[model samples]
Target: MASTHYTPAQLALHWLSAAFIIWALVMGFSVMLLDVTPTFKATIAGVNVSLSILFIPVFAVRTWLRLRHLRDHGHRPGERLAGVIHNVIYAVTALVLVTGVLMMDRPIQVFGWVTLPQPITDPVWDHRFHTLHAGCNGLLGMLVALHVLAVVKHEVVGKPVLRRMWVAR
Candidate 1:
């Protein structure tokens, strides 16, 4: 039989990913929309770049675990749609990360400790990547909203979906 609750590792990773993604989205858009000084904007961008680079490994591990789980346990009845939505979310997240990295026009400096040369040097290509990254982020935001709503809907219908995902005391 399939396990009713997610593993503790899965629970931890889920919350971690949620926190990082939400923070990035909020800070990124705020930097664009608000009248922040150029210096302040650059600071936020630098920090975000570092954080996102750090997050890539975490997301990779999470994706691996998810795939392993699906392979071992498969989906519960009537959960195929949920599985598809989740796959789409993962694909978009990968795109967002890739585009974010590719859009960089300067050397990637991580917390002042490490620096990697920019992957894309052409200004035009960088701008294209930036546009794609923004679009992907928007789609990711919508998907996250839908995910939250689905959880709320399940709860309203007396399903303990959150409880299953929640870390045990």
Candidate 2:
């Protein structure tokens, strides 16, 4: 029998990470559609920095929980297909986030007050990372869509896969 249970920490991390990624994508998309004024760019930069900081703690906890799961359970599922897909999902997600941080070119300010050093300052570096981040985000989005299609197919046509990422659905 397949294991359908995801520990509470795992479920929480799964949804939280998904929500953060979606929020970041929406924010970036929205900001880019506007005219680029200094103040406007600064505002979006601040938001990016704040969200990146939030990513740090959540990713740390998520990684730790994953390590703990591996250490505690020597018996991992032998389902090679799902395991590979999961690894690909995380790799693309992490690449997008790390590159996004590296693409920052200006100081981040909080509501016209305090400022933080730009996460990345070099224009060439920023340009490279920006391209990579966008590319990875696009690739990751497609992969996520495929993953979701697979999950829906499983739920409707076969055994459910989303239960492993959800709260006992």
Candidate 3:
């Protein structure tokens, strides 16, 4: 019989990833599209850059856990499409992270503790990477919306999908 609940580590990673991704998406779009003050925009950019840098390792660990779990447990029945969609989400997330690093026009400062020089120096190439990063990030946002909708649908149909992922008392 298949276990109904995700492991504790899995639950933690999932919630952490969800919160960060949603926050990033909202802040990113707001900074790009809103008429915010330059100072405010810069502050948000600095914080987001630092967070993204720190998140890289967390994402790597999450990916490793996901792959290991899949190998150990295999896929459940009728989950092939969901698996494919999830893989696409992961791939787009990887692109977003890589392009974020590649597009840096300024030094990456992680919460003022560490500073790494920009990865791409050429203006033209850096702009291109930025464009790609924005596109990939948008795709990730859409995929996340779909994932949430699927969970809601499952809940409505009495599957208790959210319960499976919720922290146990």
lDDT of 2 by residue, 94-161 (tens): 78778876787776554545666778777998999989988897888788778878888889987766
Cα-lDDT of candidate 2? 0.74
Backbone clash tally for model 3? 0
**Candidate 2 — which pairs collide?**
none
Q: Between prediction 1 and prediction 3, which has the larger lDDT?
A: 1
Ten-residue region with minimum lDDT total, candidate 2: 67-76
Summarize candidate 1's per-residue lDDT along 63-114 as a digit string, tens digits. Answer: 9999999998988878889889999999999999999999999999999989
Better of 1 and 2 by TM-score: 1
- List candidate 3 stretches off by more than 4 Å: 1-4
Q: After superposition, how far is residue 23 of candidate 1 from its true place, in Å?
A: 0.3
Error (Å) of candidate 1 at residue 5 is 2.7
What does candidate 3's lDDT look like per residue over 1-169, in tens digits?
Answer: 4444567888898899888888888998899999999999999998889889998998998999889888887667777798899889988988998999999998899999999999879999999999999999889989999999998998899987777688874
- Against the true structure, candidate 3 has what lDDT? 0.88
Best candidate (score: lDDT): 1
Return the candidate ranking by lDDT, descending: 1, 3, 2
lDDT (C-alpha, whole model) for all candidates:
0.92, 0.74, 0.88
Estimate the Cα RMSD of every predicted model relative to the unseen true structure. 1.2, 3.4, 1.3
